[model samples]
Target: MTSFQFTKMHGLGNNYIYVNQMKEQLPEEELSEIAIRVSSVYTGIGSDGMILICPHCCTCEDAHFQQ
Candidate 1:
């Protein structure tokens, strides 16, 4: 098994699952599947969603994009 830094934060009795990958190696293509599994209310560990704190922010990190 591999170890990584994770911080599970909760508010208003609602909990969130965090998977910090700043210093870890994970396949990006498998995130959605993992999220769905983790957040599933049945047949899996229940949670609101997963929070990913990474080092890079695609192209929006330049702070010059319009939504």
Candidate 2:
């Protein structure tokens, strides 16, 4: 079993889950499963959805950042 941590936020009654990619590393192939697991109200954190925030290392506006 593995444990994950997230920051929670809400606006106008809508919930949000913030996952800091800069400090936390999650396997890209399993993001969908992780998202579903975290969104579960019974077995998980119970949020509307997950937002993966990444760090910007390049100046290209259209550049994709990955680790």
- Taken over the whole model, the C-alpha lDDT of each candidate is 0.67, 0.78
lDDT of the structure predicted as candidate 2:
0.78
Q: What is the lDDT of residue 10 in candidate 1?
A: 85
Q: Encode model 1's per-residue lDDT on 1-67: one tens digit a residue.
A: 2334556678998877778777885577776677777668784468887777667868664432211
Best by TM-score: 2
Candidate 1: which stretches are off by over 4 Å?
A: 1-5, 57-67
Models 1 onward score TM values of 0.64, 0.75
* Worst ten in a row by lDDT for model 1: 58-67
Cα displacement (Å) at residue 62, model 1: 7.5
lDDT agreement of model 1 with the native: 0.67
Which 10-residue span in candidate 2 carries the lowest summed lDDT?
A: 58-67
- Report lDDT (Cα) of residue 42, candidate 1: 88
